[model samples]
Target: MGVGDVSKRILLGRKLRSSQLGETLLPKRIALPVFASDALSSVAYAPDEVFIMLGLAGASTYIWSWKIGLAVAVVMLTVVASYRQNVHAYPSGGGDYEVATVNLGQTAGVTVASALLVDYVLTVAVSVSSGVQNAAAAVPWISHHEVVVAVVLVLALAATNLRGVRESGAFFAVPTYCFMAGVLGMALVGALRASDGHLPDVESANFQIIPAPGYDGGNLTGLALIFLLARAFSSGCAALTGVEAISNGVPAFRKPKSRNAATTLLLLGTIAVTMLMSIIVLAHHMQIKYVDDVSRLRDEQGNPMPSGYDQPTVMAQISKAVFDNFTPGFYFVLAATGIILILAANTAFNGFPVLGSILARDGFMPRALGSRGDRLAYSNGILVLAFFACILIVAFDAQTTRLIQLYIVGVFVSFNLSQLGMIRHWTRHLKAETDPAARRRMHRSRMINTFGLGMTLTVFIIILLTKFLAGAWISILAMCAFYALMRGIRRHYDKVNLELAADEEDRFMPTKVHAVVLVSKLHKPTLRALAYAKATRPNVLEAVYVSADDATTKALVQEWDDRNLGVPLKVLYSPYREIVRPIVEYAIQIRKASPRGVVAVYIPEYVVGRWWEQLLHNQTALRLKGKLLFTPGVMVTSVPYQLESSQIARDRARRDSERVKAGDLRRGTVRSGGRVPPGKQVHR
Candidate 1:
């Protein structure tokens, strides 16, 4: 194997055959972390957002933190329930896009796809950015380099995911579970301490929140108060961002895919809601003062917080307060939280690629995205997601607050539409069903989806009203751009399909084949091309050479005539010393002369084994082939003259093919005889 191949093998592991795709399927245990990490990790920042938004009206308004958390929880659970119907109905992993397309037509489906696509990109950005921001709490140095760290984390996640789903899942499972355990354990300890009247105050508890300009004194009652609450709720609703990923990834689950997926979704929603509320209640009880602006926090003496005072995340504060006696527990919680937040991007890494594959399969995306890489993963899709995510992280400076504003807009757009699609789905099914038992179940699902639609629609409107000017417009514009792009791709694919459709004219043979051999020297390759062109037995045969120098051209003609090659040679003299343009012009002239006939151009090309050797040969032939390919009725063929170096490439390919891969022995793909695979042969 070559260096590149060895490096790829080391990075991605051994390539698996198509049949081993089943081995990548996840059971419920693994699927939970793979698909639910985004939702579960949201607890780390969701409460902070709630507190930040409420802090706009000062600490007194912090009393509404748990209320906002409860509201988000209700919406989250409703979304989870609604999606249970989705997985059961559409287990093909299309998720919202599939539901919207099948029920609401192509436009709605494409819109949902666009929204989900943008949202998935934002998921990676916001999740990784938030993780880095939280990590900055413990490692103050990370704060100055957040953008660089976040970009690197995004790339690392992409590389891990490129290793295939099962392997990536197994790698991420530990951190995800540890995060859950750490947060829940911290919450449990906090609750116990509170019951025993021994809970300590968080670091920010003594700081007073200075309300924003408009909400001074926290006594505003009217549209201003309503708007403030709405903005806070919208920010809090960021928790619902990744709920649809599970439905989109149902196919990744093992047998009884839908059931296992539904169970996972339920668990995700329950755990996420519990953790979110726990954090909010604990922060409120401990009087944790989280804010977007550090200046908004004042000390007990009513002085602004000192400069360079690094504020810890709400989770970090809670962990410190809850585990104040056990220093390792505090660090463990912070470490787990930070790691899980980063791993949360894994959910998008899995969902986006699968969705991209589906979109590609449906012709809305480039076909390359539909293809599996050596590891059987959608490598193209993963790379694309990572790339766009890095751009966002850099553009926004990896500020979670800034990215979070643009985050949930796309998700809510998808959520509302997906829920609407599910409602229509159940309605459509009910029309064709006569069995009372099944009808009852359909009615129940429809009602659940109807409620879901109402809830999501309300949240969607709230998000638009509250966040449009706060960078949400950018996400909306992104979704619109994606929608138009996908539609344009579909139209292009359709136009190409229509144009390429075989017709009666396609059945007719060309009137005659005029064969022309391209030559630059009187050599064996030129003679071989002449022979191959003659073997075709065309109606007209000639050897054409572009003469950039008269002396060399005269010598070549003299040699050709001396050899009596049995074919006339036509020399086109170029004043500009251009070889490809003159040959292209000649081929086009021949094609124009006989529109109903075919012009066959045979060019001798050198096939070299070494990469550097390739640049040394085939330059003229490659350029000529490229130009002639666009000429109507012209056929370009490469007559390869293999050099001695090509033997090296052949040997390398043989060694690579004979090399044994993982699982080859167990799969019986390798020879069962005593003969070992090439690399495994023992030498005494």
Candidate 2:
């Protein structure tokens, strides 16, 4: 095996045969973390955002945190219910884009696709950014290097995901499960501690959160407080960003895709809500005073402690406060939370590529995205997602707080469109189905979708009203840009399709085929080309050679007579010693001389097995073929003559093909076609 093969085997594990893909199908336990990590990891930052927003009106407003949590939970449950219908209806895994495109019009579908695309990008940025911040809590060096750390983490996540969905999921499953267990365990411990009156106060409990300059007293009521609550609710809705991934990735599940996805969505929603509410309750009981600005949070002496002070993430603080001085608890919570946040990006990694593949298959994106990678993955889409996510990370400097404002906008956009689309989907389906039982089920599903639509529309309005001035517009703009680009791509493909259609006019034959053999010297290649041209029986046949030097041309003419060649030889002389330009001029002159005749240039090419041999030959032939291609009425044909070295390469390929044990083509198989020939130079 080559070094490349050896390295791949070590990294990707043993290759699985195409027939064994079913064996890699995820069971519910593994599937839970593989697809659910995004929603589950929201626990790491969602509570902090809730507390931060509420703290804007001072610590007393923290009383409203549970209410905001309830609102988010309602949205979460409604979305989950709605997506269960989505998976059942659109099991191809196009998610919102498919639903809107099929049920609504193309515009609506594009809108949903754009929203989902933006959301996927933000998912990576927010998840990795949050993970880095959490890690910075444990490692102070990472605090100052937040953006860099976050970017590296994003790249690492992208690489892991590039390995293929099942493999990536399996690698991250342990950390995801650990995070779920750790948070639930910590929440339970804190609840028990609160019940026993032995719960320790959070480290920040003593620090008072001074309200923003405009709100000094507790006198504010009516609309102002309502607006504040709405904004807080909007920010807290970041927890809902990954709710649709399971729906989007239904095909990744085993048979009965909808059932498996629905079950997984249920598990995701339950765990996410439980963890979210638990942390909020724990924070309230322990009086954890979270503020937006670190400046306002000060020591008793009223001195600014440090410029880049490392504040642990909200979940980290809760874990430390609840599991105070317990080393294992602290590290467990820290490790799991950080790891889960990083793995949360995996949801986007899986969903974006699958969706991209669907879009590409539909001709809405580049066709390359539809092609599977070595691991039978949509490698192009994965790389595209990673690139955009990396851009956002760099642009936002990896600040989770800033990125959070932009987080839920795209998700809510997709949620509203998908729910609305599902309503239409059921209405249309109901019109065709005659069974009463099926009708009744459709009606129930419609009710669920209708409720979801209402909830998501409300959340969408809240997000726009609250977050439009705060970075959310960026996501909106991004979605619009993606929509326009996808439409343009569709139009380009449509135009090409029209242009390439075979017509009666095209069916008419070419006026004539004027064949010419490009000869360097009277060798096997030149002789072979002349023979092939004669077989074509064109209207005209001639040997065309560029004379860079007179002696070579004279020797070639003399050899032609010595061999009694069949066709007439025509030589084009070049004063500047250029091979391509003179021949190009000669072909153009031939077309102008006899417009009814077509020019067919047959060039002889040498093929070698060793990489070095190619450089020694074919430079002139390649240039001659390229020049002939541009002239009107001309078609260039290459007749390749295999050298001894080429036989070696052919032999190597045969050996490699025979040695294919299992999944050699399915795993870690990068293309090796564009190799340079040994001992020769070639044009680019």
Candidate 3:
């Protein structure tokens, strides 16, 4: 194989046949990390956002941290329950898009798709950025270079995911589980210490929070206090961002896909809620002070924190205080938290491509996205998600706080729509059901959906009211743009489908075929083209040459006449030294003369296997074919004469194919006796 092929094989591993797709299906153990990492990892940063928002009203307002966490937990559980119905009903893996499309209309479906697509991109950005930010707490050097690190992390995650679902899931499952263990272990230790009255204070516990300009003295009441609490709740609701991915990825689960997926969702909700609340309660009990602005922190003497003071993240502070006696436990928690946050982007990497494939299959996206790559993954969609995510990371300089504002708007938009769609789905099903048992089940499902809709709708409105000016508008605009672009793509596909529909006119045969073979001189390639054209037995045949030099043209004509080649030689002089234009003009003339007939042009090309040799030959023929393809009633054919170098390439390919891969013999794809099986031969 060539260098490029070798490199690709090393990077993506051996290609699997289409039948091996079933082998790639994820079991519940692997599926949990693959689909739930985003929600689970949110505990690493979601509490920090809550504390940051509440710090606007000073440390006294921090008392509301656990309350906000509870509110977010309720929304998350409701969303999880609602999507359980979704996975059972729409197991084709369309998720919210399918639900909205089937129950509502096409517009609603497209809107949900646009929102989900935007949110997936944000998931990667926010997750990676937050990871980098948390890492900065332990490694101060990373703070200055957050953008580069975050971008590299995004690319690394994309490459890992390109190796297919099962492989990537196996790779990420350990770290995800480790993160869960570390955080929960730390929380457990902190609880034990607190019960014994031996828990140490966090580093920031001694610093006083300076309230913002409007909320001075932490004595707010009325609309101002309500708005402050609303803002804090909205920020905490980011925990609900990735709950829909499981519903979207139900097909990736093994046997009883919907049941496994529902179980995974329940586990995701329970674990995520537990971790989130644990972190918030610990931070509050330990008086962990996290703020957006460092100047807001005051020392015991009421002096502002030093300019260069680097405050650790909420997780970092809590871990340090909880594991103060054991240094290794603290670093382990931080390391696990950072790694899990980075791996959280894996959830989006999996969900985005599957959803993109579905969208492409439905004609709302480019067809190329629907195709599987050599590894049987949606490589195009993965690359697209990574690219946009890198752009966002760079554009915002990888600041989690800045990107967080643009994060949950799209998810909430999808959540509200998805919940509404489920309500309609159950209602429509109930209308058609006659059995009392099934009817009662449908009623219960509808009620759950109705409650879900109300919860999500309230959260959506709160997000809009609290975050619109805080960069949420940008995400809304992005969703609108995606919606319009998909609609336009569907329109173009439909128009092309109509234009290409076969009709009686397509059945009509051309009256005659006027054949013209392109020639520069008398040679084996030119003669081969002449013989091939004559073999077609067209109504008329001629050899056409573009002449830029008179003497060369005369010699060629003299040689042609001396040989008495049966076909007439036609020479077209080009004063501008343009070969393609003359041939295009001549073909157009022939086409215009007999509009109902076809003009066939034959060009001889030298096929060279060496990459550099290819550039040295076929320049003129390549340009000529490109021009002729655009002309109506014109057909261009390439008669290739393989060069000697091509034989070397063929030999190399043969040797490469003969080489045994790792699992060929074990899988019975190749025989140990060195004899080929009937249908197991490699064709490429």
Question: Which has the higher lDDT value, candidate number 1 or candidate number 2?
Answer: 1
Query: What is candidate 2's CA lDDT for residue 633?
Result: 86
Query: What's the TM for model 3?
Result: 0.97
Per-prediction TM-score: 0.97, 0.90, 0.97
Model 3 misplacement above 4 A: 662-684
Candidate 3 C-alpha lDDT tens digits along 548-635: 9999999999999999999999999999988999999999999999999999999999978788998999998988888888999999
RMSD of each candidate? 2.5, 6.0, 2.2
User: Which candidate tops lDDT?
Assistant: 3
True-vs-predicted CA distance for residue 345, candidate 3, Å: 0.4
Model 1 lDDT tens row, 1-684: 889888998999889889989999999999999999998998898888888888888888777788888999999999999999999999999999999999889999999999999999999999999999889888978979999999999999999999999999999999999999998899899999999999999998999888878789547688887888889999999888788999999889999999999999999998999999999999999989988999888998999989988888899898998998999999999999999999999999999999999999999999999999988999999999999999999999999999998989888888888888888888888899999999999999999999999999999999999999999999999999999999999999999999999999999999989999988898878888988998899999999988888889889999989999899999998999998998888888887888999999998888889999988888777777778888888999888898899999999888776777666566555765533654563443
Residue 319 deviation, candidate 2, in Å?
0.5
* Least accurate 10 contiguous residues by lDDT in model 3: 675-684
The best-first sequence of candidates by lDDT reads 3, 1, 2
Better of 1 and 2 by TM-score: 1
Q: Write the per-residue lDDT of candidate 2 for residues 349-442, one digit (tens) a residue.
A: 9889988888888878999989876677787898899899989989989998999988888888888888888899899989999999999999
